[model samples]
Target chain A: MSEDHVPGFNTLSIHAGAQPDPTTGARATPIYQTTSFVFEDVDHAASLFGLQAFGNIYTRIGNPTCAVLEERVAALEGGTAALAVASGHAAQLIVMHTLLQPGDEFIAGTQLYGGSINQFNHAFKKFDWHVAWADSTDVSSFEKAVTPKTKAIFIESVANPGGVVVDIEGIAQVARRAGVPLIVDNTLASPYLCRPFEHGADIVVHSATKFLGGHGNSIGGVIVDGGTFNWMREGRYPTLSEPCESYQGMVLGETFGNFAFAIACRVLGLRDLGAALSPFNAFLLVTGIETLSLRMDRHCANAVAVAEFLSSHPKVAWVSYSGLPGDRYHALQQKYCPKGGGAVFTFGVKGGYDAGVKVVSNVQLFSHLANIGDTRSLIIHPASTTHRQLSDQQKTSAGAGPDVIRVSIGIEDKEDIIADLDQALASA
Target chain B: MNHDSYPDAYIREILDSCRVIAMVGASANTVRPSYFVLKYMLEKGYRVIPVNPGQAGKDILGQRVYASLSDIPEPIDMVDIFRASEAADGIVDEALALEPRPKVIWMQLSVRNDEAAAKAEAAGLKVVMNRCPKIEYGRLSGEIAWAGVNRRTVSSKRPVLSGGGFQRLGLGKGRTSN
Candidate 1:
């Protein structure tokens, strides 16, 4: 890599955040596992604490290993800065904490991960924050739901459980009109597949536990600040606009300029909330992201084959994969994620709930687990598992009807993955 | 943006120096968080003027409600916003247009607007976003320790419960035994 030559996505994935370790020249990002960093001198410590210089003070605030992961993801997503947290949920929490005030409201797409629905519907209410549900399929619903109190609009890039591709640009326009930031959960369609920021999203969150980690070994989340939203434009976000009491009258937005939101999340939200990502997890995620482009391509190809097989199968009542031609979200898939509609998709079995359970239990190669983005195929009956907490109507709206079976196609042989599903459906 | 965290010493400096506040987006509803925070600030000796277009000509927490920040007669030291994050921009613009202008713009907990904060700071105003002054007062006065939220400061001393009641801790430094 050189200053003159621009690196491609694959090259940047491996080299963007990393340089030869200054101390030991280690090619791999060394896990700075300890809790604190040594200061050069009294002035250096003062400078760091005073925001006069940039350096690690503690693992809870920042770390070398984690910094690399953050930089890599930021580069991958075309964002100014990124903050890594304990899990995908933690990332959303910090982001909302930075944006939503008690009694403030935000609009959310009805079609979201079951866990996200729980977090927004039940948990966010505890903070006095309200959520207005909107239909992702109908962009006008989002525009209609905007109120003077609406702070943000949230949607998943390729909605979980079902492979429904969202119209990111349409919703982004609505957010723009309402003077709110558009937050996109890019967990399913990693940057290799869809870059939400490029389309109009101001912030992108990832369940690094999924595609970014690729291996499913580490639980991590990331927030990429697109650095596009004008926090000072309307004075809507006082957290970034005003002097933080936590730090003497230092105004984060005024001081940090474009990416002040990220800084606030780090100093204020993460500092107080304590959902810091471990250095070991950062190291593992960095390694996994290195092969993201390669794995994602295979994942998409395998998923298309599996979806086609399922659509024609006698046991499957319907298949909801955007990759398939004539699917409802096929045009959206072409517009948003031109490369692929991602590996995850949903299909309803003819035998309903009982058959859904049988198919999940009968799978051999595809592990029946509460996870996705694994190198190995995975399956789940969401009605009885991931979406169990949701109401019946919620389950249906989220495309997790009782008969729906979700699959995360992996980078395995297309025939093997299809064969596994064939046997499972036969048993059902 | 990486200006870093502000220490407790600075926080104390700002709190110690500030006085009269004009609350933007103040609501008349008793259950609203803005109403309670306004009530708390008023009880703390800070003269607070509630600003809400809908509540204009009415009284909330004993203060006459004004339609906007500019309509308030007195020179306000701080403008505490109780509105949504998107509303802060226009409020900041209005605050900046005032003759003396507010010395500080404090957004309630979870309200943050980076752009508005920058403009205010550039014009020599201090801004605090996504925080509650009532919560800060309680934590700084060592009054919230009973609920176990103030981790930055740890004192073995038990907090004094004011005669006015424990809930009034958001008011001032009167409740702490320390």
Candidate 2:
């Protein structure tokens, strides 16, 4: 309880948003399995509904269990507040729903998870939200994409599968000039590796289904409000700046101030979207986060070793892990995620498409799957699986060329992981 | 001192030392943030006198309302400016003219005036801007953790709550020895 004592990352990971249960004094955060909370009386009910008080009413709006998860992620990201939802996709949906109006636009890095690319390109169009693609490796691409209609700029802290560390500060400047918020997807590099807020990002989004829920057991996503962006500056974002008819002319940006974006996401988007995370999944994710530092350390170590092995292998054409000193993004990795490159990266098999598929199918220890950031190593031949629908030109542009292979290195002993990949490569 | 950041000791000291607060622009509307902030301060055993020209002489959370700082008869320990940044200058000027002048001038969240802050600081009054004392109190006392927000500080010490109506924690325990 020293006056200036700030919690270490490991401490905040475990205890930031948690205390013992008040009613039962439960040491572990018990799952509040019920859907709704009972009000003490009519006055209390009125207060809760009117946003006059802070308490739980319905699980769809806010659950006690999910609130803990949201708080912990927000704390880790150095954000003022956070909101948790059913999946990473749901997290993205709620975020866009809050920021964008009909026919508005957001700029996203071209190198992204295929799922997000799809979400922005196809699903978001239904809401009349357009996605303008930019090259994260080149910050000027983001600058060129800026227009009056651009509501926000989005980038991945570390691009998925491509394994490039983005220059968050450079793009943040573009966002600043454009009068928009820079949203960084820190799913690849958890808070242990990189905190987006510290690098001028106005908001940080995470697909907690991956690294944040390290075991790959639960599906969840979180949005962390950096509390940096002034949502009222231009009145571009009416959801925050304007008065809400639903809540008696209360202006969220004026009332909530720094944490208004998070409040709006919860009270408006999630309330209507009905994407509430199950309490059990939140509990599991919470437990997963407690060991984040430990798991991430091993994840980074195993990934670097595996990348080194692949780079030297006879059948490997190239390895794209920034942890490698000679890799293109090595310097950027050091600048942003000095700890390590992270668990996910990509490489090229010498024999092209057939070899890539063979390597994935031949692995014993590595699970051939679409997911990453699991305790178990996962391998995917994207050209054959996820990118099959796209043309070869599209696949290459998306960083899923014919010879490309993606792997999410697990926290298992490095030698064991290398040994598994070695045999798999030999068979291929 | 940097207006963007404050040391924990600075914020903790201000919240702990100040007992009576005069909240300018406090509203009786339940949904407004100022209303809840006033309620929370009262619940935590801090006496908050509401100040609003419109709501003057009315009872807000059972505390007497005053039209202005000069009108209040009691010695104010702190003036919590819940008004906008443009209005902070006049509020600080009024606070500076008080007899046995308040020790602190605290601006609420997103309300900051550098000129007004400099004036207060020059007069030997501590100033904190763009921060909510309720959030700080909850953070320092580990009460924010109950709602799953990061208190930012780590502590193993259990909070000692006074025997009272609501179990609100205060930063007064360890500071008393100081």
Cα deviation in Å at residue A196, candidate 1? 0.7
Ten contiguous residues with the weakest lDDT in model 1 chain A:
A1-10
Query: What lDDT does model 1 reach?
Result: 0.82
Fraction of native A-B contacts kept, per candidate: 0.00, 0.27
Off by over 4 Å in 1: B1-178
Colliding pairs, model 2 = none
Show model 2 residue runs off by greater than 4 Å: B1-4, B7-19, B28-31, B42-47, B57-64, B73-76, B86-90, B96-103, B113-126, B141-148, B157-178
User: What tens-digit string does per-residue lDDT give for candidate 1 at B1-178?
Assistant: 2223444544555566678888988877553557656765665667889999898989996789999888898898889998889989999999999988778888877689988889888999888887777666655654332111212332223333333432233323422211
How much DockQ does model 2 earn?
0.32
Candidate 1 lDDT over A72-154, as tens digits, reads: 88878888678889999999999999999999999999889999999999999999999999999999999999999999999
**Shift of residue A390 alpha carbon in model 1, Å:** 1.1
